[model samples]
Target: MQQDTIEQRPDAAADWPDQIYDLLKLHNIRQVALVPDAGHSRLIKRCIADNTMKVVTLTTEEEGVAMMAGAWLGGDRSVLLMQSSGVGNCINMLTLSSIHRTPMPMIVTMRGDFGEFNPAQIAMGNATQAVLEAMGTLVKRADTPEDVAPTVDATLRMAFNTFRPTATLLGQRLLGAKTFGKD
Candidate 1:
């Protein structure tokens, strides 16, 4: 049933950026911190150019972790965008959300699975799910656009309402390999 819905929409596999923006808008999320990666390049570009969202590019993924903490302190809802490799860098700080009781949503572009040509991505991608769960985050994988909007909305709500982190895994099938548009 779910497979049929995903197969019917080609955009479901590639329209994560727009769908994510729609979810954020629906949730009233306005600020974001990100560590750039090929998977999220289109989304990041759209965020940078979009007047509606305040996008901050960080030096490291952990910086994004800290930045979100700060954003929450300032009363702005936000999410961190990064790749699976970045997850390793952000692991230790995962407890920050637990300690602070803040649901800091993270929208992760995952690799290390099917259609992944990059050898470097495989390990991190495989460990991504376990790592997120181990750190006490509720993880949801959005392999298609049809799944993205609802999953993101739910993740955000979980993070905020439950006061725990929620991670949405945007799989490679959704983002593709080639970085689209600008350099």
Candidate 2:
């Protein structure tokens, strides 16, 4: 299959999520397991509106891990959407995906990296990539809006086609820095 590629630009970031949704459909990803997060709110909404995909809201990040593993075992392709903080919650459970060589692809919205408002989000946010790598999951970063679609496209191909656990970290800059309080 020929892979579609897009040019990255500052203004193009806003369109990346939509591009990601299109790629999801193109890849035939039927199940989506996610812990609701503002970072992924738009993509989540897109998935819910599409009847073709089964979108599962998870109680915890680890639950999404297990859900994707089960989906893969049952012969369905799935993806997990979560924030950087949730990555910590999935560390031990990630072993399940890694050990079985499950094709677990994740879209992780980064926090505590750039323009972070909450101090508590710092630790896990910073450790997200390293932790996933330690568990044998391939990690990719989309720091620019242009990088989003291509990164997701390639990661999806790598995860499902290559049968490798993978994650794409969407930088806070691309998602917009979270504001703590209303003015």
Candidate 3:
């Protein structure tokens, strides 16, 4: 199969995705929850193929939130991956982490902010950061190949240390805008 725009991004060659996967292992995160998004393809594949990790493919982003809650309750470290558009779906569910102080770590691949082709995607992507902040999520961003490891490592430390809901947004600048086939 051919790679998509996200996979062909220069950062992919730099292997920020691998750095993220390594950090996940370093943190001993045993569970990976996500819905399919091209920006996360490599990392998702890595987590799925790793026997030490249990990857949960969720139908919606909110389900990952609930599942992470359960995973933490069961004494396993977990993280969620989704696109900027999906953040809207988890608005209410994020309360689970905020009110209870659960360690919910999320990696969101941003869209609609840079070279976005789909006008529909621009709104949520534009609002994701502010909305997540309003909902009490500690949001960080990784906008370059060099930003991946440091941002993710720091977000993980923050989330696990204080049980705060944290997210590291893989910005459009980092993953490149999904320009599929437009001019």
Clashes of each: 1, 1, 0
* Candidate of highest TM-score: 3
- TM-score winner, 1 or 3: 3
Instruction: Indicate the TM-score of model 2.
Output: 0.88
- Predicted candidate 3 versus true structure: per-residue lDDT over 53-150, tens digit per residue: 99988899999999989999999999999999999999999889977789999999888767776678889999999999998889999988889999
In order, what lDDT does every prediction score?
Answer: 0.77, 0.82, 0.85
Output the worst ten-in-a-row residue range by lDDT, candidate 1.
1-10
Candidate 1 per-residue lDDT, tens place, 1-183, comes to 222221111232466577777777777787888987766666777788878789988888988888778888898898899888898889988878978987689988776755655677678888998998999989999876678888888899998888888999877676543423333
- Using lDDT as the yardstick, the better of models 1 and 3 is 3
Q: What is the TM-score of each candidate against the true structure?
A: 0.85, 0.88, 0.90
In candidate 2, which residue pairs get closer than 3 Å at backbone N, Cα or C atoms, i.e. clash? 8-146
Cα misplacement distance, residue 4 of candidate 1 (Å): 26
Tell how far residue 83 is off in model 3, in angstroms: 0.4
In terms of TM-score, how similar is model 3 to the real structure? 0.90
lDDT of 1: 0.77
Q: What ranges in model 2 sit over 4 Å off?
A: 1-13, 177-183
Q: Which stretches of candidate 3 lie over 4 Å from their true place?
A: 1-12, 177-183
